[model samples]
Target: MIGKFLNRINELSMLRDNWNYEGAKPIHATVCRQAKALVVRLSENILKSLVVFPDVDGTLLFDVRSDNSHSTIFVCDNFFSYILKKKSGNNEVFSGCSWNKDSDVNAMISKIEDSLS
Candidate 1:
């Protein structure tokens, strides 16, 4: 179970690394929102599969750190948000919201799978 959870985290990290949104502002925002939602869902599922306690809510916090940057995915309260800071400076590069639909989340997952090849 731990392995499966780690694999999912790795998959999400890979997706984050390979996500390239060169489109318009609205499109980029949509993609980012979807990706954040997917990350939250994946984290929640992993915690649910691992924890035995039924009331173990708010105790688990999953964060995915970037390998090449100061970006991070923070999962909380059934939502996930991404914060990206500049590599050379202490400034934020981008920050995404924390809401997305099921279809958007699934689409983001599909895009990640497609990037794996």
Candidate 2:
């Protein structure tokens, strides 16, 4: 279902301003591109329960939940932020920028894998 996630991300881009009935901004094109890139980097296992959507602030949001954990990754124009909640009640929260770099993408991939495990 990675395809499903990607499709949803694309759908989110069609949302208009105030789509949420609360004056929310539409999803930014840059944010959608960044989100799709991140999704493409995900492993199938981590993609299993992943859901992609947009936030009111024009960023993309990715959420994945396993039996013992839950995580969220927010994608903006050139950066990403994530919150990983572990089964043991510990949480990992961080943000990184610079989508033009391979290292940043790799770091996000690694963090996502850890969150899902």
Candidate 3:
């Protein structure tokens, strides 16, 4: 699974500018590096629930879904934003956060993991 994740991320690097046919930016190198590092750190359970994709803006997205909830982490050059939706229809958003801040990222990951569990 980790191999699959790494392969998908690496494949993003092959995308050229305007790959979306709408003047979309190519995948940013920093975003891909950060995303690969993140994927390596994630637990197997979380990885199993994850979906990785790139946005037209050259950012990376990690989407995790469970039967009762969904969470998304949007990764930019040096930071990330998270959105979480619960079974009860509650939505929470956290934006303009740095990925270098381990505490913030860890807390978000833990919350998502716990909710999914």
Please list all clashing residue pairs in model 2, or write none if there are none: none
- lDDT of all predictions, in order shown? 0.36, 0.84, 0.88
Whose TM-score is greatest here? Answer: 3
Q: Which tens-of-lDDT digit does each residue in 1-117 have in candidate 2?
A: 767878998899999999999999999999988888788888998898788877999988888889878888888897777888888888888777568888877886787687666
Residue 1 shift from truth in candidate 1, angstroms? 11
Better of 1 and 3 by lDDT: 3
Q: Give all TM-scores, in the order shown.
A: 0.31, 0.90, 0.94
The sequence of per-residue lDDT tens digits that candidate 3 reaches over residues 1-117 is 898899999998788999999987988999998888888878888899999887999998999999988999998998889999998888889998888899877877787887687
Better of 1 and 2 by lDDT: 2
Ranking by TM-score: 3, 2, 1
Counting clashing residue pairs in each candidate, in order, gives 0, 0, 0
Q: Per-residue lDDT tens digits of candidate 1, residues 34-80?
A: 33445455533333433211012221223333333333333434354
Root-mean-square deviation per candidate: 15.2, 1.4, 1.0
Residue 56 lDDT in candidate 1: 20
- Lowest lDDT block of 10, candidate 2: 108-117
Angstrom error of the Cα, residue 94, model 3: value is 0.9
